[model samples]
Structure formats: C-alpha cells, structure tokens
Target: MDVIGTSGLTKRFGRVTAVDHVDLRVPAGARFGLLGPNGSGKTTLVRMLLGLVHPTSGSVELLGRAMPRHGAEVLPRVGALVEGPSAWPHLSGPANLRLLDAAGPGGRRRDRRRRVQDALERVGLGGIDRRPVRAYSLGMRQRLGIAAALLRAPELLLLDEPTNGLDPRGIGEVRDLLIALNEAGTTVVLSSHLLTEVEALCTRVGVMDGGQLVLTEDLDVLRAPTGHVLVRTPDPAAVVPLLDGQVVGRSGDALVVRGDDAAALNARLVAAGVAVSELALQRRTLEQVVLGLTGTGSDRVDGGTT
Candidate 1:
C-alpha cells in the first residue's frame, strides 16, 4: 500500500503558488527522495502531507487515512524532522527528548524514560546526556531532533534536509542511520538540496521545478547510461564518417556516438583504420540530470514553507 498519497495537491500564498497541482505517491518501504531547487515547492508539499499546511485544493491520504480529518490518528505513526532542530539550550539532550516525548503521542509514564534513552543511544547522543544542549554541536542537535522523531517508533519518517548543518562525519552518521532504518522496514521521505546525498541514500527520486513535479523514477533508471558511446581514436577526422549520423559531438580528443551496439561501433572504427585508444559509454550523474531538468544550477531553494 502507498504510505502517502496526494491528488491535485496545491498551496498558494496570495499571489505565489508554493505548491502546484501535484499528485504524489510514496509506496511502503520506499526510500524516496524529494529533490528541487529553491522555490520548487518541496517543503510545501511535505507540509501538506503532514497536515501542517492546509492545501488550497485537492486531497491527501497518509497511511490510508484522509489528511487533516484523520491527521491526529495517522500522524502519531509518522515521524518528521523539518526546518532544522529546535531545543531548549539550557536543557540537556536527554532532558529535551524526555520533554518532547511526553508532549508527543503514545508515550506512557512507565516507558518514557527507557524510550528516551533508547532514542538517544540510537542517534549516538547517549554519551553526552549530562551536557547542556547549548554545548552540543550542530550535528548533535540534528541527531537529537531525529531521536525525538523516532521516540514513537514510527513507520514513516519525513525528514527535510536532515543532514543540512552536519560535518562530513555527522552527515555520514545520519546517512547510515537512515539506511539502517529503511532496511528495517521504515519508509523514509527525504527532502534535501544535496543531490549526492539523495543519490546515495534513496532508491527512488522525484524532481520538482517551478512548483511542479517534473520527473519521478527509480534512481538507478534515472542514472542509467544514455546509450551514448565515447570513443577516443588517434585520428578523429578519419572516424567521423564511419559513425554515420550517430556522432553526437566531439569532446576534445574523442568522438561521442549515440549508439547502443558498442561492439559494432568499435568494429567499424577498427575497420575504417581508425586506431581506437578508448571506447567508453557515457552515463549521466544525478547532478547532471537535476541540472538538465531544472535548467538552473542552483542547489537550494529558500523561504516559502521550507
């Protein structure tokens, strides 16, 4: 079953349409990534799904229940960490989690302490239980926020830029944790400006542009080779004609051919007396795909619901 589904989902702030008429579905056990540059409406869409923002038009169903109407029933089963972490500076990490957990649903008096400690340990923040939150690093705070989200052992985790402020180590920690969670049957929907992070962690990806979902597909398919072959020969001028119209362009000392049969192309190159030095297929990276889809190199989208 689809853990999250929306139809004709849209949100407009006066003259600005933050989220366009978008239809989205996230199947159970999917490590889905929602990617877009600034103002592409990723955050707005997440908000609508969580019932944090009322959509201007359309319907939403999360965990098979209608949104807003059944949000109280459904949201308890979902965890979210959006717009960075917020905690009481004077309070210790464990204390902050205890407070947040108490306020959240499904925590019983007998299990609150043990649940909070387990969450802290899960996020790698258990060692600093006595330290004030103000002394914790940005990454620690982010992890604490994640622990808070996990306190209820949610089935779906909606994380927006969960690795935003972390160092390389912190980013790796979060990445590994999310991967482990997904492997254990939790569906994760990650929204982030980091395309590389999405590429590494998510099995499926959705690209948004101008507040519209431009593309959505499996990550492997999206990054698959485009059947374009790159050939490097001693004589580029001599090999150009042998490829017929398959020549896409020339890259410095090589010829780019749009063909699937690499062996045939190689044979033709050799038959034509073109000394082939290299024959390689070209593949597009996730970054390249995103750039081509958005037409803008901007990595981040600011303001407006994010």
Candidate 2:
C-alpha cells in the first residue's frame, strides 16, 4: 500500500501559494526523498499531509484514508519530525518521551517506556535520560526529535531536514538509524536540501520547485545517465575527430566526453594513432538535472500546477 499519497494538493496563504498542485506517493518500506530549496514549498506540503495545514483545492490521503476528516485515524499511525525540535526546555529527555507517549494512542506506560528507551538507543542517545533538553546540543535535539517520532511505533515517518545541524559522525549515525527503521518495515518520507545526502539514502526522489512537484524518478534511473566516458590523450587537438557530441572540458592531457558510446570513439582514437592513457566512465551528478527541473537556473512560472 502507498503509505502516503497526494493528488493535486495545494495550499495558499493569502495571495501567495505555498503549495501548488503537488502530487506525491510514498510506498511502504521506502526512503522517499523530497528535494528542493528554501521557499520551494516542501515544508508546506509536509504540513498539509500531517493535517497541520489545509489545502485550498485538492486531496491528501495518509495510511489509505482522506486527511483532516480522517486525520485522527491516520495520525496515530504516523511518526513525524517536521519543522524543528519541539520539547520543553526544562523537561528531561525521558520525561518528554513519557509525556508524548501518554498522548499517543497506546495507553500502557511500561510498554511506552520500553519503546522510548529502544528509540533512544536506536538513535545513539542511550543513557542520557536525566539530561535536560535545554542542555542538549543541536545534534542531540535532532535525535530526540526522531525518538519522539517513533513514540507511537508508527507505520509512516515524516522528517524535514533531519540532519540539518549534525556533524559528520552524527549524520552517519542518523542515516544508519533510518536505514534500520526502513528495514524493519517503516515507510519514511523526508525532505532535504542536501542532494548528496538524498543520493546516498533515498531509493526514489521527488523534486519540487516553486511549490510544484516537477519530477519523480527512481534514484538509480536518475544516476545511470549521468555516467559519462572520460578520456585523456597526450595530444588534446587530436581527440576531437575521435569523439561525437560536444566535448565538456579539456585540460592539457585530459578531455571529458559527454556520451557513453565509447566503443566507436575508441575505434576512431586507434585509427588516428593518438596515444590514449586515461579512459573511464565518469559518474555524473544529478544535481544539475534536479536544479533545472525546479527552475533554479531558469525563468520562474506563476501560479503553475504540476
């Protein structure tokens, strides 16, 4: 089942459209990445899906039920860390977990405590229960936010920039934890501006720009076309006739060919008797394609629907 689905979902704040005709689907046990820059409506879409914000004209379904009207039924099964860390400054970590658990669907305190401890351990926050939230670092706060999201043992998890302020080690720790959760049959939908992080973690990605979902493509499909055959010849001037398509770059003995059909090019190189040393497939970054789809380097459209 699709853990989260939206069709023509839109949200307007006064005259400005915060979310415009967005459509998304997050499958079960998948790390679906939402990619966009600031003010691109990623946060608005998250809010609408979580029932914290209402759409002007569209529908959203979470856990197979239409939202807001069925929000009560769906929310209990969802775990979210949207926007930022929200915890009482004076409350200890464990106490905060207990409070959130009390408000959760489950009523058993003992079970909730066990779940809280497990979640804390899962995020590498074990044995830090007595520390006050005010004393915790930004990375710690992020971990706590994730732990709180797991309080209900939710089927779907929504995270917005879950690694916003983490160091290298912290980021890796969180990434591993998320992978473990997905392996255990949890659906995760996360929005991030960091393309490298998404590339490493998500199986599929939905790129949004100016409040519209511009593209949805499998990660592997997006990355495959990016690999190009790079070549370097001792005589840069002699390589042009050996290649098809525009040459991307040339630096002394190096040249970058933009296509994958290197066999024909290689034959031409041999025929020309040009000494070739470095020739390999270069991995292309999907950042440019993603940026182009969102109108990042292009003209913007007004009141557009995706």
Candidate 3:
C-alpha cells in the first residue's frame, strides 16, 4: 500500500500559493526524498500531509486513511520533524523527550522511558551527558528532535532537512540509520533541498518547483544511462572526428560520445591510436536531472534597479 498519497493537493495563503496542485505517492518501504529549495513548497506540502495545514483544495490520504478526518487514528503511526527541533532550554535531552512522548498518542506511560532511551540511542546520543538543552550544540539539538520523532517507533518518518545541522560524519550516520530503518519495513520520507544528501540516501525522489511537483521517479530511473560514454584521453582532438557527431560534449581532454557501449568505444579508441586513459558509461547525475527540470531555486531574489 502507498503509505502516503495526495491528489491535486494545494494550499493558498491570501494572495500567495504555497503549494500548488500536487499529486504525490510514497510506496511502502521507500526512502522517498521530497526535494526543493526554500519557498518551493516542500514544507507546506509536508504540513498538509500531517494535517497541520489544511489544503486549499484537493485530497490527502495517509496510511490509507483520510487526513484531519482520521488524523486521530493515523498520526500516531507516523513521525515527523518540521522547521526544527524545539525544547525547553532548561530541560535535559531525556527530560524533553519524555515530556513529548507523554503528551503524544500511541505511547504508554509504562514504556516511556524505554522508548526515550531507544530513540536517543538510535539517533547516536546513547551516551550523552545530563546537560540541559541550552548547553547542547546545534547538531545535538537536531538529533534530539529526530529522537522525539522516533519515540513511537513509527511506521513512517517525515523528516524535513534532517541533516541540516549535522556534520559530515553525523550526516553519514543518519543516512545509515535511515537505510537500516527502511530495510526493516519503515517507509522513510526525507524532505530537503540538498541534492547530494538525497542522492546518497533516497531510493525514490520527487521534485518541487514554484510550488508545483515537477517530477517523480525512482532515483535509479532518473539516473539511467544516457546511452553515452565519457572518455578522458591525453589526445581528445584525434578521436572526435573518428566518431563524428557521436562526440556530443567535450571539456579539456574529456569527451562525451554517444557510443552506447563502453567496450565498443574503448576498442574504437584503441584502434584509432587515440591513447585512451579513462572510459566509462555516462549516467545523469541527480543535480543534472533536477536542474534540467526546474528553474532557478527560490533562494535567489532579483529586484528592478534600473
């Protein structure tokens, strides 16, 4: 079953439309990445999914149940982190989590401590000190937020910019943890503008631009071989004419040729005395795919000065 589904979902605020008509589906056991830059509507869409924001038009179904109407029954099975993690400055990490768990549904009082500890451990705070939240670093606070989301051992996780405050190692650790959870049958949905993060962690991706969902596909399919080969040789000029129009692109000593077969391209280069040094099939990078499909991200601003 699709853990999350939306049909023509849209949200408007006065004169501004934060989320346009968007149809999204996240299948069970998928590491689905919701990708878009700031103001691209990713956050709005996520809020609607969790029933925190009412859509201006269209429908939403989460865990096979309608949102808001059935949110009482469905939200407990799902976990989420939006905007950022928030906690009382004077409270310890464990204390903050305990309070959140107690207030939320789907967690029993008897199991609260175990749940908090497991969640903290899952998020790499297994041995943390008894410091108040005000003393925690930005990364530590981010992890604490993630732990709160996992307190219920939810079946679905909706995380926005999950790696925002993390260092390289922390990012990798989080990525590994998400993968492990997905393997264990958890459907993880990560919403971020970081292309590299999504590429490394997600199996499926959906892109938003100008509040519209412009693309949705499996990561592998979007990165399918372009039927081209990337060749890097000391002598690129000599091989270009031999392959004629097959050489679609070149940079310095490198050439992109529509050879389809890497072996054939290598053999041909060898026969032509091209002195090949490197050769490989060229596949589209996630950045390339997203850039081609979307315009300038919303982060950039322009004003008339002339």
Candidate 4:
C-alpha cells in the first residue's frame, strides 16, 4: 500500500518554480529515501506533503486520503521532523515535547510523561534533566527534535536531515531507530542530502533534480550489480592474462573484469594458478548513480529559495 501519493505536485514562488510538476509515491513499511542536491525542492516538497505549504497546483494523498483537505484526520497519523527539529531554547527537551504534545491532538495528559520519556530514550536522550535546550549541544537538540516527532508514535515518520549535527554514534543511533520503526510497520520518508545515509538506510529511493522528480526506484535496482567483477590480487600481472579479453579496466593490483558472476571469475582465476586475494562483483555505487543523475548542489538556483 502506498502511504503517500502526489500528482503534478508543483509549488511556485512568483516567477520561480520551486517544485515542478512532480509525481511521488512511497509505499507503506518502506524506508523511503528522498535525495536531492540543495535547491532541488526537497524541503518544499516535504512541506507540501505535510500540508504546511500549499501547492500552486497539484494533489496530495496521505494514508489514502486527500491531504490538507483531510489533514486534520490524516496528519495525526503522521510524525514529522522538518527543516531539522525545532524547540523552545528555554525549555528542556522533555518540557519542549510536553508542550508540543499538549498543543497537538491525541496526546493524553495522563500518559504524556511516559510518552515523553520513551521518545527521549528512543533518541538516546533519556537522561536529560531541567537544563534548558539552550544549554544542549547541537547534537542533543537534533535528537530532541526527533523525540518530539516520535511522541505520538505515528504510523509514518517524515524526517529531513535528521542526523544533521550528530556525531557518528548519534547518526548510527538514529539509523537504527528508523530501521526498528520500519521493521515494526511504520513507513519512513526521509529527506536528506547525505547520499551515504540514504544508501545505507533506504529500501526505496527518489531522486530530485532542479525541482523535478528525476528518478525513483528500489535501491537494489538502482544499485544492481553491473556485469563486471573487481579483483584485487598481488599478482595482477598473472591474473590479467587469464581474464585476457574480459579485462575492461585496471589500476595497479586491481582489475575490472567484465563478467556477471564473481564465483565463476574467482574459479577461473584460481584454476589459472592466480592467488585470488580479493574478488567481488562490481556494481554502480550510490554516489556514481547520483552524480550521474544530478548536477552539483550549487548549480541549482532556486531564486533565493531552499
């Protein structure tokens, strides 16, 4: 089931088209990655999805219901942390979440404490005290924002640059939490410029370029193994002749042999008395695929827009 669907979802600011006539779809229970360079309309598109920004022309559906039209009903089932998490600088993480929960629908006063605690713990901030968010580090604030989004335990999570300002450990914690949530049947729609994060966490991917939805495919399909194998051997001289016409490219002790199966290539090399130190299927990297499809981030001019 598709949790999000959009048709001709265009957003414009005067003469500038921030988001073109783009169509986007995200399936349920998927770790969907929304990738784009800066000024590619990723954030604008996310705002439209949450009904925070109305589109110039287009339609949106969330959980199979028309968005904005049914936002009151649909939004409660969705959790969002956009443009990074925001909180009152004077309030502690728990207090910030408490106020937000109190303001939003579906938060029970009786359960608010437990809910806040759980959200914080999930984000690795359960030990926080009355220290104002202003005293917190950038990484702590980011985690606090995520905790706020998780307070409702919504069926869907829409996070943008979620791990921004996070250390390597914090990043890993967020990734693991998202994976756990997806495993438990909550669909995740992540908007991030971090290509590596998307490559690591997403099952499906959507690429945006110049406000257009340029590509959308399963991660496996986008990164399908090319019909080549990479072999790293100390004896490159000996292995090259065995692969002969099959060798496409090489660098020092590394060889790119044109073949689909690694096992077969390894067998052939071993049979030819070559010491196979390392051999594996060569596939298009996420970076290679993205770089090929997208221009430099600065190339996109959104007319002073983000």
Best by TM-score: 4
**Cα lDDT for residue 84, candidate 1:** 85
RMSD of 4: 2.7
**Per-residue C-alpha lDDT of model 1 across residues 116-199, encoded as one tens digit per residue:** 889988888777758798998888889989998898999999999998778988888889999999999999999987998999
Per-prediction RMSD in angstroms? Answer: 3.9, 4.4, 2.2, 2.7
- lDDT-based ranking: 3, 4, 1, 2
Query: Residue 53 in candidate 4 has what lDDT?
Result: 97
Clashing pairs in 4: none
lDDT of 4 by residue, 1-306 (tens): 899999999999999999999999898899999998888999999999999999999999999999889999998889999997788998888899999999898778999999999999999998998999999999999999899889898999999999999999999999999999999989999999899999999999999999999999999998899998899999998876676689889899999999898998888888888898899887898888888898665744575532
TM-score of predicted structure 2: 0.87
Model 1 lDDT at residue 73: 92
How does each model score on lDDT? Answer: 0.88, 0.85, 0.92, 0.91
Q: How do the candidates rank by TM-score, highest first?
A: 4, 3, 2, 1
Candidate 3 residue-wise lDDT, 139-171, digit = tens = 999999999889887899999999888999999
Q: What is the lDDT of candidate 4?
A: 0.91
* Candidate 2 whole-model C-alpha lDDT, 0 to 1: 0.85
Worst window of 10 by summed lDDT in candidate 3: 297-306
